[model samples]
Every structure is written in C-alpha cells, then in structure tokens.
Target: MTAVGAPQERAELAPLVTEPERPAPARRSPRRRGRMASWLLYAALAAVTVAFVYPFVWLVSASFKPRSEVFDNKLIPDTFTLDNYVQVWHEAPMALWLLNTVIVTVLATAAVTVSSAMVAWGFSYFRFRGRGPLFGLVLATMMLPGAVTMIPTYLIWNSLGQVGTLTPLWAQNLFGSAFYIFLLRQFFLGLPRELFEAARMDGANQWQVFTRIALPLTRPALVVTALFEFQAAWTDLMRPLIYLRDSSTFTIPRGLKAMLDQFGFGGEWHWEIVVTASVIATVPMIVLFFLGQRHFVEGIATTGSKG
Candidate 1:
C-alpha cells in the first residue's frame, strides 16, 4: 500500500509538459527594417543635394538684387533690377572677352584631345625601343610645377614673337599631357588586341585603325577627355593674365579680374555688376555639364576598368 501511494505521489509532483514560449512577436518585420533604411538613405542624399545646390541658388537670387542687398542672406530681394545686366554689357568689353575665351578654349581643347589620344595610342599599341623610357619621361613632366616653367615658357614664346597673342596659351597643348595620355593608354590597353589585329589583317593602316576603329569605339573616354580639356581652358586665368597684353584680347577670367580691380577696389563698389558677370561666365559650364552628364559619369566610372 505504501509503495503504490509513493508512485501516485511522484506522478502528481511531476510538472506538466509546457509548450516552449514562442519568441515575443518581432518588434518589426525584415521588410519594415529594409524600408526604414532605404528611406533614411534617400533622406541623407536629399540633404546633401540641397547643401551643395543652395549656394548657387543664393547666387542667382543675389544677382538680381540691389548692391546694398547682396549680402542680406535672403533668397528674395526687396528690389529686383536689370541694371546689373545692363551694366554687365557696358562696364567692360564682355562680348570681346567672350569671343577671345571661346577661340582660345576651343583651340586648346581640340589640341589636347587629339594630341593626348595620339600619344596614348602610341604608348599602348606600339612596342618600339625606348617607348617605356619615353613614357616615364612623360610621367616625370607632371611633377614639374607649371609656375616654375611659366617664365621660361613665356620667354620662349616671346622669342618666337608669339607672347602677346592667344597662340602662347593654346600652343603648348600640341605636346600632349602625361596625365591624359596615361588615362587614355589604360583604356587602350583594356581594348582587345584581336580587334586591332583583325583590322590590320584587312589592310587597314594605322591611321585608319585609329580613326575608324579605336576612336569610334572609345567614344566615352574621348568625350570625357574633351570635356576636361574644355573646362581647364575655360577656367584658366593665369595663362591669359601672363600672355594677354591688350584688354581687347583678355579672356573672360582676365576681364573679370580687371573689372574687379577697376570697380571693387574703390568707394563705388559695383557688386551687382560683378555678380552679373559671374553668372554670365558660369552659365556655359552649367549648360555643358547638363548636356554631357551621362558621358561624364561614364568616363569617370569606367576610366581604368577592363571591358
């Protein structure tokens, strides 16, 4: 009787089998977490865009404001005037300056693109003796400061009787650049040797191969190079400052500097006109960027990448 009673007691004391507690429902679903992160990322990008773009917006608005209100930190001015634009036309030889800038920039940009591409082609495709050494020399050129070479170059151009004109500004591009050549060479190396071999097998000369095959296929890199050259030429002030003797031949930057010296140095500082001139000078660059943004982005993205 005692043994049977003990067995019954043991059975009663054993705990009931309990289902494991389901983990408390997740605070948020995976889909919800992903959506939250995506939203946060977009918000960050939007903020950065506004930060970069706000200054230009302010500049545009300030260009229309009165001189007294230029620094007011207000997007909308109390008074808007076209007097600034009117002044921009008459205050200096802006039209002449624009023409000079266009001529110099266009010529220099073309020279740089053509010369750099040719040099790059030689370095990439040719295997002559001293080719490696010559490339090394080209790279070494990049280390020499332009300022150090400026006086010597100017004297050389002066000796040639070309110092006072725009030729000195653009003529140097005929020699090509180490940086651009290196950039294009890498792209050329990535190109399939088979295409060039196939073209040569068909009796296409080097010139024909470069023009018909290489250039056409390397449009993205070429466009990028041209755009960079264009911007460099456009924004150059020092070259014009050194070489341009006549106000009539001054590039836009040099003319703008002259304007600042004439107007901003004294009692009657015409800030509005200065601002207006800046807007005129900057519009072309903005337009160019918008037009070639696709190509610009591609060139940067795939510059050194294999096909």
Candidate 2:
C-alpha cells in the first residue's frame, strides 16, 4: 500500500511540471535581389541626371570657347575668354533689354498673383445665380487656343489705345488667368469650412476673411502661380514683338534675335557671342528656380494632395 501511494504521488507531481514557452522564429531579412534592385535603380537615376545636365555644361563650355572652336565637341575648352560678353554688350542694348524684362515679369507676376487669389476666393466662397455658368466659362477659356485670341485681343487693346506699349502685357491680369484661378480655387475649396464660418461669426467681412485667413493659408498656391507668371513674362517674345517697335524697349529674347540677325549666320557667325548671350539669358532663370525650388515643391505637392 505504501509503494502504491508513493507511485501515485509521483504521477501527480509529473503532471504539474509544465513545458517552457519557445521563442518565436526569427524573421528572415529581405532578399539580396531587393538590395540589388535598389542599387540598379539609383544607377539608372544617376545616368538620367547626367544626361539632362550635360547639355547645359556643354553650353557653358561653348560660351567660353573662341568662335573657331565653338562647334567642337569638347567638354572643356583649352582657351577661355570674356571677349564674347563684351561684344554682346556693345552690339545690343542688353542692359536695357534685361531691365525691361524685369519690369514686365515683376509687374505681370504681381498682377496675376493678386487678381487670381481674389477671383479664386470669390469662386470658392460665394454662392450666387449663374455661378456655375461663370465658373464653366472660366474653364472654357483654358480650352481656347491662346493664338486664336491673339488677333482679337490685339484689336481690343488697339481700340483701347493700349497697343504698342507694356499695358497690354499686364492688362490681361485684370481678368485673371483661367488656369491659375482654377488652381487657387481648388486649393481654397480644400480649406476647412468651419474656419470661414468662424470668421464670419466673429463679425469678419468677406474681404477680411480672405485677407487674413484665406490668403495666409493659400501661400503655397500663390507662390506657384507667381512663379509661373514670372517665367511666362520673362521669356515672352511674341507679345513684345507685336507691341514694342522701339529697339530700346526690346526684351532679352527680342534683343538676342536682333543680335543673331546682325551676326548673319551666312558669314563669320560669332557663335561664341550668341552662346554667351544665351548663357546670360538663362542664368537668371536658373538662379530663380533653384532659390524657389523648395517653395515650389511644397506648393505643388500640397496643392495636389489637397485638391
């Protein structure tokens, strides 16, 4: 009986002993192929970067070379000189041309920015009769070819006595751009309605709400719109050619054309001078783009995300 009791007690103690918890299997790291794929992607991107940048590098190199070597496919010139720059200045009124470009770009960009913002605010915030039709008309303008309206616009400006001057260049801003207005209106529509309601409840007028709340929140859109306007105005050739008759008022592109005409591709073409002028014309835009790149990226990203 004593042996039987001992055996039973041993059996009960064996049942109380539990197994320890096993650790989870370690997760396998990502495959080597994935890492190789990432490296290959980076290599492809680097090649593409070089392809885009090499042309500009060649342009600068060509600008420094003498006319005899301007067409050489060399990455670096054996000789470099500033004579081309001096000739460019002497041959044309580049200084005045640049100044005129600056004025037109600045004024047009400002007008477009302010007017677009105001129009966007109204379209986004207001509700009225024919509102849908008006907005639809604005969208329709974007579809119309700018060239189609060129003659009509010229006629209207001519009738208003604004032709042959800078007025026509900027007067279009009063109506605001269809594209920019739509861009900004989309941005405004993304804003919290409660904020506008709160402003109104606080006795804020529509103008005050726009000035204080809407404008501040929509800064990215404004910057992008302004940048676009600036670039357009800066590089515009047709408007200036049609409106400006005086050589003194020539913008950079027009002035460059005149320089090329003097050089006469038929004989003794000063390729160096032409290339140098091209470099100079492009430098300011490059600087502006790089300086504002951060804002541009932010603005475009947010606009797309919100819209």
Candidate 3:
C-alpha cells in the first residue's frame, strides 16, 4: 500500500471541502439597509412637515410685512413693521373680541366635556332595556349635517330670546355633543369594571365612582376632549355669524370676518391688518396643541384599545 501523491491528496481534500458552497454571494447587511430606509423615511417626513408648516410660517411673516408686500409669497419681508399688529388693536375691537372668544371657548369646552363624560359614563355603565338602541340613536345624530338642525336650533334659541347673545354660542353644548360622547364612551368602555364594582362595595355612589374613579382614570381622554372643544369653539365662525349681531358681541372668528369685510375686500384695503388678526387668532390653537400634544397623541392612540 503506497502513499497517495500530493496532487491526488489535494484533489481528494478539495472535493471534501466542496468550495464552501460559494459563500452565498455575501448579502448586504440588514443593519445598513435599515439605516438607509430610516434616512429616507426621515427625509420624506421632513418634506411633509415643511409643506404643512410653510403656510403658517408665511402667515407670520406676512403679518409683519407692509400692506403692499403681503401676498408676495415671500417667506420674509424686506421691510418689517409691527404697525400691523399695533394698528389692528385700534382698527378693530380686538381686545373685546379676544375676551369674548376666550369666555365662549371656556364655557363651551367645560360644558361639552362634563356633559359628554356624563352621557358616556351612563352608556358604558348602565345596563337596561333599549340601551343599545338609545346609544345607536345618539350616535345616529352625528350622521345628520349641522345644516339640517341649524334652522330649528336657531328658532329654539330665538324663541328663548337668546339670539344675538353669547348664550346661543355655548348653550347648545349643554346637551352633550354626539361625537364627544362617542369618543368618551369608547374610553369609558375600556375601563375595568371591577373598579366600579369595588367602589360600589365601598359605599361610593354612582357619582362618586364617576368623579373620583372614572374621570381620574380617563384624564388623557378628557384632556383630548377639552382641547378639541376648545379649538372648535375658538375657531367657530358660522354660529357666531348667525347669532352675534353686535360688534361688541363678536368672537375672534366673527371679528376676523368683520375685519375681512372692513379691510380685506372693500373697506380700508389694509390686508396686512387682516393677516395680523389671523395670526393672532391662529396662535392660541398652535400653542394649545404644542402644550397638549403628548396627551393628545396618547389619548388618540389608546382610545379604543380595550374597547
């Protein structure tokens, strides 16, 4: 038995090694691909953010621009003037309008939040005949456009002689909005039933269970609700236009409308003042969103999680 030659031995070992199966072509690293994907996503998001934010940025810039330079589509004005803001307060009853808007927004927000929460809690906790039908009926109200009920609502307020007053602006919210009720009901339904049962066993009444336990547990939802109503009431123009006849009674939207009528179209032709007023009107809502963004996002994300 003689030993094999070196070439024969190498050839036999090469077959055993089998060329390491060609190394599978060395795929790109998953981490590198992920990084590239993330960068692209960030770039897309940045573009979208700029698109949404540019108008507002232009609005603020125009508010500082002279009347002749507004609508120039420039992001910054060559000549800056605070005169538009200063003159706006004088040209219109801005202070009074702002105060009126604040009052109405506060009233409307509080009323809707409390009323909607009550109705939602009732729907979530109570077991009764026709409960499902009643809830369905309440929800069905949302399908009807506001125009369908506006005339009848106006007549009701007119019959009560509350027309041309702030009462009509916020009073309608006392009945609990169908949308807010639905939103809050979803949150309430997600709560633990055992908590309410325990509260009852501890001799806490229904109201206590609601105020002490339910409200506290659903603070994020309530904040979301209040923020929504606040923005809605603050930006509401149609109701104010229909109900408020006097300049002194005007909310910010109504006042801005008045400014548009007086300045933007045919009155003074001082477009910068109207732009200034719009910036002022918009700033509060922007501030509010920034302040409550965390709870707003959390509440929206978690609303129907359990329900």
Which candidate number would show the highest TM-score if scored against the true structure? 3
The reply for model 2, stretches above 4 Å from the true place, is 1-32, 264-268, 298-307
Alpha-carbon lDDT, every model: 0.84, 0.83, 0.89
67 Cα displacement, candidate 1 (Å):
2.5
Between candidates 1 and 3, the lDDT winner: 3
Local error of candidate 1 at 187, Å?
Answer: 1.5
Model 1, global lDDT: 0.84
**In candidate 2, residue 124 scores what lDDT?**
91
Candidate 2 vs candidate 3: which has greater lDDT? Answer: 3
Model 2 has an lDDT value of: 0.83
**Candidate 1 ranges with C-alpha deviation above 4 Å:** 1-40, 301-307
Model 3, residue pairs in steric clash: none
Look at candidate 2 and give me any clashing residue pairs.
Answer: none
Q: What's the CA error at residue 276 for candidate 2, in Å? A: 0.9
Per-candidate TM-score against the hidden true structure: 0.84, 0.83, 0.85
Clashes of 2: 0
State the lDDT at 100 in candidate 3: 98
Tens digits of per-residue lDDT for model 2, 150-268: 99888998999877677887778867898899989998998998999999999999899999999999987888899878888888888988888788878888877777766747365
Residue 53 Cα positional deviation in candidate 1, in Å, after optimal superposition: 1.1
Ranking by TM-score: 3, 1, 2
TM-score of 3: 0.85
lDDT per residue as tens, model 1, 1-307: 1223357666554334222443333433477886898799999999999999998888788889988998898978889887788878898999999999999999988999899999999999989999988988988887898888889889999999997799988989988877788778887888999999999999999999998999888777788888888888988999998999999989999988888887777545887777788888888899989989997777767654633
